[model samples]
Target: MDRITKLTSEKPVIIFSKSSCCMCHTIKTLFNGFGVNPNVHELDEIPGGREVEQALLRIGCNPSVPAVFIGGELVGGANEVMSLHLSRSLIPMLKKAGALWV
Candidate 1:
């Protein structure tokens, strides 16, 4: 909750991820491809990770990993990200969030 908020606020784009989740990898790659240097927290490898994961769950992230925050707001998981991309809304959002320069 508070911790998540704090973490999300520290960056223009933030991705809460797991080290081995393929979907997480894909989402990260997508952001990188767009030139957005998101702050990534590998929950599986960090201290208090399980508790952070639980917090994510309580906040409505079903699978939890790959939770993305853009401009300090949750943009959801892989599916949502891909949907936004397909709709051509992702890059604009990234630009608005100051995550992308172009």
Candidate 2:
């Protein structure tokens, strides 16, 4: 169990992504910019990371590179993430997950 898995299985916010993914990098940067520490998993490195992969797959996700999971819930791809951000809902959701500071 790596840091990401441990965090996902325990923490409130988890992001599974690949190193080459711009969306992954971007979302992470945004969280960091907000002074938030989000747990990250890079599927490109882990073997049999399919549980997370399959979870995303069930939602008709097109392997767009980065998958965001909140409180062990799959929140969808980058666009969904961006949508939440634009609506100012992401931070509130994070707070609900206890993943954000007050």
Candidate 3:
């Protein structure tokens, strides 16, 4: 869970993911397209990915890939992330967190 600590208080956006999710890849591509430096924590790389397991316990979400958080607020799965991006809310949120300019 040390990596979890690194994630906490470190970035405005954090994406918890697995390698196989198309939505996860899309979200990463979306962030890149926006020039946002979203911190990605691949669950596969974490110890047992137990951190994701714990997050599921806390959030009550069933271990879905691409668990995204913004300013430490759990923003939910990929569709929600894409919705935010589509509505242009993601950029404002990033700006609020100093993760983006304007």
Give the winner by TM-score: 1
Could you give candidate 3's per-residue lDDT for residues 1-102 as a string of tens digits?
455545746888888887777888988888888788888887777776866557555665455677777787778788887888789887888888777884
Model 3: lDDT equals 0.76
lDDT per residue as tens, model 2, 1-102:
343445567767778888878889998898778777887777777775666567556666677358777877768778988999999999999888888877
Q: Which scores better on lDDT, 1 or 3?
A: 1
lDDT for each residue of candidate 1 in 1-102, tens digit (9 for 90 to 100): 899999999999999999999999999999998878999999999998899999999999989989999999999999999999999999999999898886
Indicate which candidate wins on lDDT. 1
For TM-score, candidate 2 versus 3, the one ahead is 3
TM-score of each model, paired residue for residue: 0.98, 0.80, 0.81
* Colliding pairs, model 1: none
Pairs in steric clash, model 3: none
Query: Best to worst by lDDT, what's the order?
Result: 1, 2, 3
In model 2, the clashing pairs are none
TM-score of 2: 0.80
